[model samples]
Target: MNKKITIYSENPFYDKSLKTRHMKATIFKMVTLSSLLFSLGFLIFFLSDIVIKGLPAFQQTYIQVDVTYNEKTVKSTRKAVNKEYRRLVSRSWLRTIPQQVIDNPNLMNTKIKLWILADDQVDQYLKGHHHNLKPKYIQSVDNLVKNNATKLRFNIIFFTRGDSKIPEYAGIKSAVIGSILTLIVTMVVAFPIAVMTAIYLEEFAADNLWTQFIEININNLAAIPSILFGLLGLAVFINLFGLPRSSPLVGGLTLAIMTLPIIIISSRAALRSVPDNIRQAGYGLGLTKIQVVKDHVFPLAFPGVMTGSIIGLAQAMGETAPLIIIGMVAFIPDSPNSIMQAATVMPAQIFTWAGMPERAYVEKTAAGIMVLLTILISLNAMAIYLRKKFEVKW
Candidate 1:
């Protein structure tokens, strides 16, 4: 009979070691959670500040005034409104009075009460912002407020018009349209070329020194400062090719060059995500390599490719440095009708407005930022939706 003794070998510090490990893990988790919370707090603060400052720009102050559209008023728009209200009314709005009468002859010789746009100073004072309004003009605005003659109406002109020297008359229409056109050109030029380059490099090209060099350059281009691309565009497109300096064509071409590396990298990743077995299956069916890639692999990768393209476009849409370098910062007051026309994008417009020395422009700048943020958020959401919608589980 053998007496079996159970040997219990436990270190005396085992419990202490376990407790120490647990304490370290708990501390790490707390640190990470604090960092996450801190980031969220800052985001909330920034969003709240932007919203609060921007909301007022959607409404514009209008004053009810009696306008006599006669010969004298047509000659001198200041005579359209009464003497006391002339200082309160917007000069830009008043300048349009003669044209309005010319377009509608019935308005001539009519004594009608109308709600008209107020001066930027009057608008600021009404919105409780800092204004350089004279004491008399401030008192006049207060009186109108008391009598319910001044009201903040939805600013339809802000959406319909273009940039103006007057803050109240300025709008983002030109910038918005320019952005759309520039993005269109960017997508049209970059998308097909990038996808083809990515397909060739990832699917067909042999892995050699030349291929490795190209791959390295593409990666390096992605990391290059965007402003350098602007310089390249200035040198190649504008200087060498003689493309219009501030045109959307030049801006788009420039942005396309900058966006190419991003789309290529992302498209390659998308193509690689397709399993090799899919290609093998296509080849088993006696399909050519091109047919295998075109018919079998591309469709599956299309969603991811689109997602990356959209994200890249969104990034390009918000970029100002490159466009500014190519002269897209020019003050384009009218929406561009063609790609060859000089244009300014939303970011450039925002930059311009942010520099203006007016209290009203502060709200306009914030509002422009809000609009830009909304568009960017929508684009990112679209990318997410596309990824989720077409994702293959396998």
Candidate 2:
């Protein structure tokens, strides 16, 4: 009998497959990192543009006018400013001079110098932006600046007042208040229902054709165009239900419909992330499925659910299309005192400003964008913090 010797050798096919997979993985990682960098770069460019356009809104150009509050000038406040410089002063300020004199009658035909806001033209020029200002108006502004009469002041009106045809009088306060009311309604209506739906889908519902169909439709709804939700709101909320158009209640209801899918999808994902072994362990302890999910699964998933809900709310806060469809874009200068009253939201306010013919609106729109961006960033940051605090690693 011949002695048989067997030699063990590395499997060439397996070695080749291993090397190929390593190369593909390296390529995929490079591609993913490059894409991330490209996205971050684009975001930086966008934010930089918004900041450049918005910074000018925080400071306003003012010109000192030597007002001769005579009976004639008081009657027609246009005479308070020099004939050449009248066009360089804010018309809103010109209209208020007569009222100022009526309130404070201490000066009759007095030479009281007052620092009043300059025109949009002068404001543009002061900020080195191109304008259609005449040579004479430019000279007047230059002379005032040379005499230390024209200066930049911190704008307080932008916060305290409401939207105005005149950019100088336009403010975000009304929109801010309206947004608060609308979001309050949205949170109240959407949060609990979304949580319940997630709980049902994840725990109690039987896995059947109907459940599969519902799941598919929900995923589809999440991908639907937001504008379609707006149209739906216009049709259902405004037409069928006859809810007060432009009211925060209507706007919130519209947004709530739009937001529901997102919260449901996110909450379901959170519930699904709990390990099967955890549920098995709960059953091992004689706990029912309801108790297992409610006690064991939910506590672990709460952070994720909370994070998703906040993210969805933040998205709703920045939405404008649905509100516009529901007539929430109405020029509301006063803040709504109740959800039932007609209101305007911050995003709608920004959209309205962005469409104005006035150059001042460029800055106002940019400033509004900045504020919106800040709110979104803060919300995202909070979500991240909550996720970090409660996230479980298994």
TM-score of 1: 0.94
Best candidate, lDDT: 1
lDDT of 1 at 75: 96
Sliding window of 10 residues with minimal summed lDDT for model 1: 1-10
lDDT of each: 0.92, 0.88
Name the 10 consecutive residues with the lowest summed lDDT in model 2: 1-10
Candidate 2 scores a C-alpha RMSD against the true structure in Å of 6.3
- Over 4 Å off, model 2: 1-36, 107-109, 276-296
